[model samples]
Target: MLKRQKRSITTTLLTTLFICSLSITAHARRSGGPTPSITATPVVIEHIERNLSSLGSLKANQSINIAPQIGGRIVSLMIDDGHFVTQGETLLTLDSREQAAKVNEAKITVKDAERQLSYMVKLFEKRAVSQDELAAQEAQVERAKANLSSHMANLDYYTVTAPFDGVLGFNDLSTGAMITAGSNITTLDDLSTMKLYFELPENTFSEITTGTIIQATTDAYPDHPFTGTIDAINPRIDPVNLTFSARASLDNTNNQLRPGMLMRLNVVRPTIATLVVPARSVLFDGNDQYVYILDEEGLPQQRYIETGIILENKITITHGLAEGDYIVDKGVVKVTAGRPVKILSTEIAENHLDTVEPAGDARS
Candidate 1:
């Protein structure tokens, strides 16, 4: 009877201990002790832009090397280096005392010829000369007038004038310096606007057109971006490189950009409304790309996705995602499919949200 009582007490004690262990296990499971914590953001529907990038060079809207049309000794320098000049403004003058004397002589000859022609006409009317003789005298008067006009035109060449409104450049010529015809005296550039020349592959010819927007950056002004429009496109592709040339014009009201500077161009293509997610949310597994999304039951569901262009830490989802879907934007590698997750907070994912205001609120 004593041995039976001892055995029954041992059995009861073992049963109580087993029941306590089962209760503890159930409590831990209900409280989610094994669930992983993560940050999540909703997929956004926004406009995604694609850009075509290329290198280019900046140039002045109009540039020219000023030279003289006639050779002579420089007598006066009307413009200084880097002077802003207007159209038809006198730039320099050459010594032309000899040319001036030739013009005066031609004028005197013209007067003499006119007097002789008049005297001859009167003599012919009185029968002092024949009709043919009067005609010959009239021809002499015309020849003298032509000679005078030629001399007058040659005298005008002694002065050089600006062809357009622009800023002047430096020149070696000075007062009393002898220069030859066609010699470069200086340069002029119109800085109110600038031009950019770049090339793209011939395959993109159809996509580029006049009035397309362009944004450009240069090392000289890295922080500032210049905007312009496509002004022209080459009609034929270059046979050597199979590329087409494009030109864009931008305002240079401040005259900051200079010719020959290297620039990087971004040609903005049309945008499309699409679904996007944070770049961090996408994961790569060999040839496949995927993300972890929260299902209706709050469990992780692996989703394979197709991606397009990426910009500003955001990526476009071409397939396998929808607007308003939630994805694991942070701590993606820590969780797997069907795993229970606890979202820590929404603050961390605020930046990845679509911030576009509704149309009704926009009007207000």
Candidate 2:
């Protein structure tokens, strides 16, 4: 009899607990769930950009391989490696004994022709020479002068001179070494300035232009960053790469930069108008991203958003959200759809050039 009474008490207790749970669930359903405390922020039109980073190649303002035009035995080398030379400075010389003899012989022939022409003029005046003969003598003198000029020009080929003011590279050829014509004797580079060559995608056509600022750094000197402006842009786009090449000139008066050094560059494009929201306010679920947007009824609603580049702590909203729309910025995790939120605070966007958002009241 005592065991039966104990069973009856246990059943009563279970029934009472079930009834209380039902009542609580009914009350919650009527109330539409609990309200969450959150901070709301209106989307703002902000200036944002994704800085472009690219690899570039460094080159001197002017660079060339120093070579001789004529082949002969090298008799002299006036400058060594790493030496600065001015334009038209004699750099190297080849054996010119035979060339010098030819020039002297040509000069003698010119003088003889001139002397004969002067005697022919006198003979023609005395009627001892025909008019045709006198004309022939004058033509011989002209031909002799042309021959002399040619020999003199050939004589200058034996000597090599600096083409411009620049720094010299290594000279492997020593004096008295036999070298062929067009053999590379050394290298010369005008390092007063540097040219940075890089490519940009065709999409940056409107944003990137002459006078765009760019910063570059080389692995050789990472700490030192070089700054320059885009001075030249290739008008033609590369058909294969779909990119256009640009040239930036940086002042290297100290001669710190060298040609052929691989450099990294950053294109500092100007920021443009874009819709932005706080990065922390956005939540990602698989491939879709969403944020809690407060509705006219003060209830939180789940709104999916498409995002673009993120700068600082703000993310760009490309679609699904417009400027001046309110979103749950703080306490987003606690926000539930169709549930009212306690307005802890708010941040509203001001449509002005100043761009600073004024704070809202903190009181709920």
Candidate 3:
């Protein structure tokens, strides 16, 4: 009887220990700490835009070199360097003494011819001169008048005048300095507007058109961006470079922009409806791109996606994602496929869904 009791007690102790071990294991699994905390955002469906960046040059709206049409010794410099001039204002003058003398001689010849023609007319009326003789005398008077007008027109060439209203540059010429025809006396520019010249690839010809808006920036004023419109475009692509030229014009009311300055330009095409998510949600594995999305069971699920253009803090999802899908926005590093995730906050996801109105069921 004593041996039987000892065996029974031993078996009871072993059974109790086994039950306690199973209980501990169950409790540990139940407590498994807290799920991995993560922040998530909902995929938004809205209009997304793509911009084309290019380098270009700034030019004056209108620029020309001020020079005399005819060569002569500059007798007068009416305007100083950097002077603002109006259209038709005289800027310089050549010596006109010789031209004046020729004009005066032609005037004397005209007077002489007129006197003779008057005498011949009276004589013809009195029958002392023939009709042919009187007509010959009349022709002389017309010939003299033509000569005088010719000299007067030539005399006007001695003056140099502004062709348009603009600011003038410095000229090396002064009084008594001789200059040849077509020599640059100075430069004049209309700074009311500026032109930006840039080129785009031939494939973009169909997308670009007149009146397209563009934004331009320069190193001189990095903080300020200048807005412009497409004023013109080349009709044909350049075979050598396989590009087409485009010109844009912008207001320069402050005169801050100048010609020949390097400019960075951005042209945005029309916007299209696409699905987008925060850039931080995307993860790269080898050559494949993916993101972590919440499945029906509130677990992290790996989804491979194809992406399109990336702009600002958002990326366009071309494939493998739907509108209203929740993605891990932050703490994606701690997320693993098929693992339960504790959502720290869904406020961002809700806000995105509420703000972005669904345009359509479009992938890109």
Candidate 1 per-residue lDDT over residues 1-364, each given as its tens digit? 9999999999999999999999998787666565555777889899867789999998888999988889999999987899889989999999999999999999999999999999998999899999999999899999999999999998999999998899999987779999999999999998889999999989889999999999999999999999999999999999999999999998999888998999999998998898989998899989999999877665679999999878789899999999878888666776768766556435423432332111211110
Looking at model 2, residue 151 earns an lDDT score of: 94
Q: Which regions of candidate 1 deviate over 4 angstroms?
A: 1-42, 49-56, 123-139, 199-227, 237-244, 262-271, 283-305, 324-364
In model 1, state the lDDT of residue 141: 94
Best prediction by TM-score? 2
lDDT of 1 at 140: 96
lDDT of 2 by residue, 205-319 (tens): 7778899999999988899999999999999998899899999998997778999999899999877899999998999899999998866666678999999887778999999
lDDT of each: 0.86, 0.85, 0.85
Once model 1 is optimally superposed onto the true structure by TM-score, how far is the C-alpha of residue 17 displaced, in angstroms?
Answer: 44
lDDT of 3 by residue, 23-122 (tens): 9977865677434557777888989676788999988888999878788898898877887788999999998899999999999999999999999988
Relative to the true structure, candidate 3 has a C-alpha RMSD (angstroms) of 14.4
Model 3 misplaced regions, further than 4 Å: 1-39, 47-53, 108-149, 200-204, 217-225, 238-243, 265-273, 284-288, 299-302, 331-364
As a whole number from 0 to 100, the lDDT of residue 238 in candidate 3 is 97
Q: After TM-score superposition, what is the CA distance of residue 94 in candidate 3 from its true location, in Å?
A: 0.9
